[model samples]
Target: MNAPFPPAADVGVPVEQPMLVEDADAVAWDQSTDLLVVGLGGAGLAAALEGIERGLSVIAVDRYACGGSTAANGGVFYAGGGTTIQREAGEDDSPEAMLDYLRIEAGKVVSDETLRRFVEQSPETVDWILRHGGKLAASVWKEKCSYPPLDRFLYHPDNSLVASYRARAKPAARGHRAFGRDGKKAWGLGKFITEPMTQSALRLGLVFHRYSEARQLVVDRDGRVVGARILSTPEGSPEARRFAKYIARANMLLAALPPSIPLASITIALGNHYLRKASEIEAKARFSRLIRAREGVVLSAGGFIMNPAMVRRYAPAYATGMPNGTLGDQGSGILLGMSAGGATALMDKVSAWRFINPPKAWAQAIAVDRAGERFVDETVYGATMGEHIVDYRGGVAWLIYDKSLREAAFRQARDPKLVPFQRDVTLLNLLFNARKAPTLDALARRIGVDAEGLVRTVATYNAAARGEAQDPFGKEAVDMHPIERGPFYAMDISIDSRFLPLPVITFGGLRVAEESGQVLDRAGKPIAGLYAAGRTAVGLASQTYVSGLSFADCFFSGRRAARHAARANV
Candidate 1:
C-alpha cells in the first residue's frame, strides 16, 4: 500500500531518503524513507527528528504511541551538574571535570571517550530540545541525587557550563530530587506533562503511530536487520507482512538486539511483590548504600504508574493489552535492536530507581526492609528502585526504622497511588484501606497467604533484628537492629507485579556505538546502520544521569544516528 503523501522530493522539493529499502517480505511495508525507526520512545523520537532535520525520508513507529518514555516520565531532564559541583567545592566546573566524574563513576565500565562524548553533546541536546519545544526547569541541587548529584571529586578544565542548565531550562524548573521536601532545584512530571515537548516534536512535522508495536526485526541469514514487524499492542492484531517487507527493502540492513541485561536487572532486582511493611525498610537500607557511594537518587514509581494512565487516555489499546513479566512495553526496542544485531551487555547492574525510595503517591505502601525486618525510611525510590524490584528468594528486603522514622515518613507514606486506585491500585489497599495490620499473621490471613509461613518469616526477621539469630536471607546490608520494640517495628509489603511493574518504563537498553549511534554486539562490533539511545542503549551507569541526561542522550544519539545513516547514503 502507498502512503497518502508522495515522496518529499516530489513536491518541488529536493529532500533525500537516506536508507530507503525495497523488500516485499515485511508486514506493513514502506520502502521510500531513507531512515526507518522502530521504536518511538525517547530514542525513536530523537532519531526521527534528526532524520527530518537532515531531510531524509523518515518513517518511525512504536508498538505504542510516540511519547514512549517522555509521556511516561516525570519530565525530568538532566545534565552532569559539573558546574554546580565545582562551585560548591570552590573549584571550576569544566567539561573535563564532568568527564572525570563520569570516569570515576563508570569505574572502567565505559570508555573515557564515550564519557567525553556524552558530556560534550549534552549542551547541544538540551539546546535542541529547548529550541524545538521541550520545556525545562532547573535548580542548583547539592545533595546526592541521581548518580551522586554532581560529585566534585573529579575536575574538568572548563567551568562555564557547569550550572548553565539551571539558567538554560525554562520556568517552573525543579531540582532533580524535588520529590522530597528538601529538594533544591528541578522540575516534576506534573509540570512536564503540561509542557510542549511532544507538541514541539509534532510541530516539527514528527508523526506518531500509537498502539503500534514492533514485534521482531526482519533479518537475513547474514544477521543484518532489515526492518521490524509491528503489532498495534500486545493483544492487538499484528501488522501485515507487507509492511515489514517494505521497511526491510527500503533501509540498509542494520543490527538488532535486546536490552542489556543490566537494564533488565533494574526490574528484576525489585522483588515482584512489594510488601508494605518490610519493603520500605529494604528500600531505605539500599538507598543509604547508594548514598554512601555518592550516587544519585530519583523517584520513578509515580512515573511508572502514571504513564500508563496517560497512555490509556492518549492511546487506549496500547495502554492495556501488552504481555506481562518483562519490564516496559515487552521491550520491543530491545527485541528490535537484538534482531538487528545490536549488542546487549551490562546485565549485572540495574538502574537506581527501585532503591532510591518510593514516590509520594506510593510512598505509604513502600516499606523498607532492614535485614529481614521491615522499617520505614525515605518516601521515594530514585534510580536504585530498579535493582530493588527484582525477584529474590522469599521475596525479602529490609526497612530500617528509628525514633525519627515514623515521624518523618508516616504521614507521607499514606499518600494515594498515582494511578486510579481501583483499576491499577492493589487489591490489598482496596480491601484493607491501605492500613498496616498489627502482625504478619493478621496481614497474611488478610492477603490469603500461608499464615504459618508468614508468622515464621516475621519471627525470624524479628530474631535477626534482635541479634537472637541469623536472618535466613543472610541480609547483611540491613541497618536497623531488633524489631522487638513497638515504635521501631518494620512492616513488609509484598510488591505486587501486576500494578507496580505494569509501567516500569524502558531504560538502559542495547549498547550502541557512540559516534554513529549504531547498535553494537556483545563483542562491540557495530550492527551496521542500526543505532539506539535512551533506555534502549546500555551503560546508563557509565555516567551520572544528572538533570537532563536522559533527554539529552535521546536527542544526541538520535541526531548522530540520522546523520551517520544519511552520510552512509553518500
Candidate 2:
C-alpha cells in the first residue's frame, strides 16, 4: 500500500475582527435600520428588496460597485415542473421527474423539502422578478435543457450521465431566461434580471451605500448580532484637509470685513473654514462607520473566488482560474459568519468550466489524454469534462476531428436548429489554434500526444465511424467519422487557453439551516439575528452547481432570511 501526501495547512482567508458591544461603548452610530443587508449583488439586492416590501427599514452596502458576477453570467434559471411558460407552451412536465433529476445532480447537500420548494415556487419567483421589472422571455423553449431540473421549458439535453450513474431521471430542458439584446432577443442571461433588481431596490427606497466594505459583525455579550462595522473612506475633496488652517484664519477676519463681502462668498468661505477644522480634527481620517440593525443582519456578500488566501485554504484547484465573481468576493461574509461561530461545508468544491458542448463540431472529435486515449463522454456535461481533465488528465487535453466533420459543421453553421446561437465565437477562436497534418502519427506529434496510442485509438474509432463496428465510447457516427481520410485537424482544449481561458467560481460557504437562511454556529445552532444568503451561504448548489442555481438560491434564500429577520427580536 502507498501512503498519500500530507494535507496542507489551513492558511485561511483574512477576516476582520468582530466588534463586541462590551468593548466598544464610545463608537458613534452612523445609521440604524431594521435590517442591514451586506453586498449589492443579486442576493443582497434581493434581501434589501424583501426587507423593503415587508415595510422594514433597510440599509444595503457593497464593498465595490453594485453588479457582481450575476450581471455578467449566462443567465439561465433552471425552473422546472410545468412553470408558467411550460404550461402555456403545453410542454409535459412533472415535479416527480424534476425531483429525481435534481436529487441526482444535487446529491445530498440540499434537503428534499428546500429543493422541492425551489422547484415548485420557481414560477412565483419568476413572476415576482418580472413584477418588479425583471425579464424572462419564456415564450421560447428549446429542446435540450442546459442544466438540471428536467422540464422542457429550457434549451438543453437530458442528464444521460446521471442515468448512466444509475439514477433514473427523465430528460427535459428546464432553463428559463430573461430577454435582452445579448442573444437572439429571446435568450437573455443574468443581467436582464440583476439590473432591474438593483434599479427596483433603489426606486423602492432602500438605502444603498456603495464602496462601504463590511469589516465585522457587531455582536452583543448574549451572542445576538446587533449590527455591522463597515470600513469606508469619506467622500470629500482631499484639498479641504490641506487648507483647513488657512481657511479658519480667513474666516475669523471675515466677520469684521463682511459688510462689503458678497453673501455667497461669505457662505463659501465659512464652509471652507468648517471643513478645515473638521479635517484637522480628523487628520489622516479613519472612516469606520457603525451601522446598527434593529432586528437582524443579513450577510449576502458574495463568495471568495477572488481571494487567493481563501482559495488556497479551501479548494486549491480554484486557486488559479479566471474568476467570474465581483472584486469584493473576498470570503469576508463567510469568514464573518464563521468568526461568529458559524459552521461551513463543501468548501472544497468549485466550478472549473471549459464550455466544449457547443459547436457540436467539437463533439464529433474525441478529447484525448496524454496517453492518447478518450477519457470522458464527449457529449457529457461540460463542467464534468472540465473536472476530469483538470483532476485526472494533467489539466490539458486535445480534441481530434476530421476535415469531413468540420465541413459538415461549417455547412450547418447558419441553421439555428442544428447549432446554438453564438457558438461561432468558439468555432472561430478554435480555427486560430486548430492544427493539421497528413497522417495520424504526424498529427499526434504535432499536437504533442502519444503517436502509437493515437494511431490505435483513431484506427478503432475510424472503423466504428465507417459502420464497420460499434463505438466503444458510445458515440453515434452520423455526424462524426472516419479518420481514414487525410488532412486531420486537432485543437487543444484544456484548463488553459490563452484566447479564451476557462472561467470558474466557488460555491461553498457558511452552513445554514435548511428551512431558513440563518447562519449556523459550529454547534449547529442558529446565530441569533445573523442570516446569510447567496454564494456566501451553502444552498442548492452545495454539491454541483449549474447555470442558474446560484441566482435561484440567492433569490429564494434572500426572501426567506428577510422574512425571518423582519419580525425577529432585536
Candidate 3:
C-alpha cells in the first residue's frame, strides 16, 4: 500500500464555517409543518421560501451548510429569453415558444405542460431573485440550448473581470449596482448568496435545520409516504433536542441507510481531506445506498457524489466501453438516483468533466501546440479555446507537427507566460522549477504518443491547413488543429470538468404533472401527497443548457410544490 500523501498546508481564505448541533433528548412537539424539505441547496431554499409565502410551515434540512454547490459556483444565472435571446436578437419569444424549446430540448422526456409552466414562471422567478436583493447585469447574452441551429436562447448576468472591478468599487450602500454604468458582466463569485437565502427563509417563518442527514423515507403499509427518518447526531445542545422532537412528532420512519461513499477527494474538497477519515467516507457511502428503494425515496442529494455502478445501470450511455481515460473511473450521484427508483430517460453519452482554476503548464502547452499550426481562423480558435479547455478529454493530446512550421508560431508568442489565466502557473512556478523542453518530439514522448506517427500526422494536417478548412476531425469544435511544427511538443495538460455533463442541477427530476408539481407513476397516475422539484424530477432541458433557466425552474417548482403540498391533505 502507498503511504498517504503529506497533507497540504492550508491557505488563508475566508469561508463560512459549518454549524454543529448536539443533544437529541426533547419530547416537545412545538409545531407541525405542511412540508418537509430534505436538502437546503438552491432547490430546497427555493421551496422553503416559496412554501412560506403560500402560508405553509416548511421544514428544510441539510447535512452540510446550506451552500452545497451554490456558494462554490460562479454566480452566473442564465435565464433564457428574459434577457439574451429575446432582447438582443429581437426575436418573438413567448411562453409557448420557450416551452416548445424546452420540450424539444429534453427530447420528448418532459411533458409539454410542464415545459410551458417552466417557461411562463421563469421570468417571474428572475424577478423574485431581484426582489430579494439579488442583482443582475443589464447586458444580455445570447447562447446555446438543445434546439439545433437555433441554440441561441439564454442570458446570464454579466460576470466579466471589468464588471467585478466595477462592483468592488461601489460601496454596499447603493444596493447591488443594478448594472455597472457600463453594461458588462463579470465572472467571479458575486456575493454570499447561500447565507442571505437562509436568512431570508428563516425571516419568512420557514424552519431550517443543518447537520441533519436524511437516511430514508417512512412509508405506511399501503406505500404512502408518512415522513422521513433522519439519522442525526446529538452534538449536544438545546436546539438539537427541539429538532429531534420535531422529527419524532412527524412520525417519520427511516427508509434506508445511506450507502454511497466518497472514493477519492474531488478537487474542491481536496484542501480538507486530512479531516475526513475512512469512517466518515464510509458513512456517506452508506447513506448513498438508500436511493435504490421503490417507494417514497427521493434522492435530493447533490449529483457530485454519485456511484459509478449506478451510473452504468441508470445512465449506461456514459459507461459504455468508451476506452479508459475517456471517462473518469469513479462515479457518485448516478447510483443515488437509480437506486431510488428514478429513471434516467436521456441516458446517452454525456461527458463528465469540470473546469476550475486552469493549471499553468496547460496555458504553455496550448500555446506551444498551437504555435505554427496554420488551420482555421486563429481568432475563432482563440475565442472558443475556453470551451475546449473546459471539456478536455485527458490531461494530454498529440501536437502533430512537421519540423518547420512550429518555429514560426513559437516566435510570435515567445513567452508562454503571456496568457492571462496563468494563476495556476504562477503557483506552479513558486513550487517547482520545471523547465520547458526545446523540442516537440521530446514533449510528445513525455506525454505518451507514437513519436514517429505524430510527426507524419502533423505533416498531413499542415498540408490540409493550407486548404480553407483543416482536416475532417471538426478541428474548430474540438480545438485540435494539426500541430505540424518542428521540434514537436506534447506537454501534459489538465482538463476542466465544468463543460461536461453535470447531473447535479439536473433538468429532469420527479415526473410531476405540469400544473400541480405532483409526482406520477409509470401509468401517469398521480401519487398521493408525493411531489418532486429540482434535480429530483427529470426532464427540463436536453443536449444543451440555457444557464439560469434551471435555477428559475427550481424556484418556480419549489414555489409550486409548496402550494400543492399545502393543499394535499386539505
Q: Rate residue 10 of model 1 by lDDT.
A: 28
Q: How accurate is candidate 2 locally (lDDT)?
A: 0.70
For lDDT, the strongest prediction is: 2
In terms of TM-score, which candidate is strongest? 2
Q: Write candidate 3's Cα lDDT for 391-464 as tens digits.
A: 33322222222334334333423443233322332333222322234564565456555556545545555455
- lDDT order of candidates, top first: 2, 1, 3
Clashes of each: 145, 10, 64
Per-residue accuracy of model 2 over 1-570 as CA lDDT, tens digit each: 011111223434445566788633455778889899988778888888988988889998875556665665666666777777666656566777777788876758888888888878777787788788877654554422233221222454334333243247765556665556553422225778888888888888888876567878898888988899886535444633334344345434432221222363575466556645644544454477899987888888888886667787677775556655655577778878877778888787777766564566666678898788988667666666677777778788888887776775566455554324334545565567678898889998887899999989988877887889988766666535576666888877776655445567887888898787898887789988899999998888667666677877788888989888866643
What TM-score fits each model?
A: 0.52, 0.80, 0.57
Candidate 2, residue 100: CA error in Å? 1.6
Candidate 3 off by > 4 Å: 1-31, 84-113, 139-191, 233-299, 304-351, 354-422, 425-467, 470-484, 491-525, 541-553, 566-570
